[model samples]
Target: MRSTSLLVLVGSGLLLLAGCAPATGDASAGTGEAAAAAALAEGEASAAAPSPEPTAGDAEQWCADADVSARVDAALASDTEGPHNGVLVSPEEMAELGEPEAAIADQRRAWEALTDDEVAFQQCLRVRQGQSPVDPVPGSGS
Candidate 1:
């Protein structure tokens, strides 16, 4: 789903460039093709690139972020019973919780994991990769 969104976004951008391309055939000939090709190349490069390996510093920084630490602690303290435990809820479960299915699926794709250990590992790597915010769902207070 996210890949589709990205493709749509890239396609729209290419269309915009094509539409906005100067029709005069000025000094920069084939500018639209060039732009589209460059965009495609960039997208390919990004798609082909592997996820960066996480470092110890990345873990330390994630642990040290006060907001992140507080949020994690609060979530841990609040959730005591679910299989997901405020952290690794299934995308379907998230959809059931009022999040749109497609959006949740996109988020899950970005999440990139299913099991608890993988989720934890991905969370740390994601922090290193993008500093993506930790998502701590509020528990049902059971």
Candidate 2:
């Protein structure tokens, strides 16, 4: 009776393993079809939607507006006058300067009020010097 029970358990284990075995051609084909269908659906949705076009104003806005440039300049100048003279400003400083116009003045004032690391200070100055102010808008696109 014990031997019969052990045999039955082994047989059940074998059955389970066989059921978990890799599927052959037809199963693989079905999986591939499902994946293809998903891909097609995604493609169709993407195709149905039109991407927005970037305006010239958007381009100009991204290229460091006047407020950003001014703040960058101010931070760099503050760094120069402080104990951190000859230091380089970090990308964080640049980002702070590049913040929205409404926040720039306060940000610049805060930066000026505190002493920054020498490296961060110098870097900010260098970036400010390198940056060219935006050109005046043309009367029209000519």
Candidate 3:
């Protein structure tokens, strides 16, 4: 009876091992499909190139067209905060307000995506508009 039990256990283990073995098949069977899928993905990625960065000239034009400085002055005179174009709530404040953590993360990511020149141009415009520049900048100190 003991030998029978041992034989059963060994046979079961062998069966399990066989079941876990890799199947015998042509490795290249799906290679064409995978290559085609990869090519399609690459094409899609290449076609989705990002828009060009906004130049400082573009920022200046936007500020001028929007009359941001005058609007900011009016907002300040009325002791009201204007709709800050690029500003968002701090993560701590967002948490206190019961906002989703993802919101904070998304805002931070967007800010971090800005180039240094873009940040400088934006700060320049903000200062002109009587709003405080995002001091220390995002993804940097403070």
Q: Please write out the lDDT profile of model 3 over residues 1-142, one tens digit for every residue.
A: 0100000012111100001111232111112223533343333224433323445654464355344545433433442222332223233323343435775576556557767545554554444433334445668667
> How does each model score on lDDT?
0.35, 0.28, 0.35
Distance from true position, residue 117, model 2, in Å? 20
> Which stretches of candidate 2 lie above 4 Å from their native place?
1-63, 79-126, 131-142
Query: What global local distance difference test value does model 1 have?
Result: 0.35
* TM per prediction: 0.25, 0.17, 0.33
Error of 3 at 33 (Å): 46
Judging by TM-score, tell me the better candidate of 1 and 3. Answer: 3
Instruction: Write model 2 residue lDDT over 1-142, tens digit each, in one string.
Output: 0100000012111100001111121111112223533343334224433323434444344324555445445544451222222222222332332324433344334335434332233323333333212122111122
Query: Among all windows of ten consecutive residues in candidate 2, which has the lowest summed lDDT?
Result: 1-10
* Reference-based TM-score, model 3: 0.33
TM-score of 2: 0.17
Cα deviation in Å at residue 3, candidate 3? 92
Residue 55 error, candidate 3, Å:
24
Q: Against the true structure, candidate 2 has what lDDT?
A: 0.28
Poorest lDDT segment (10 consecutive residues) of candidate 1: 1-10
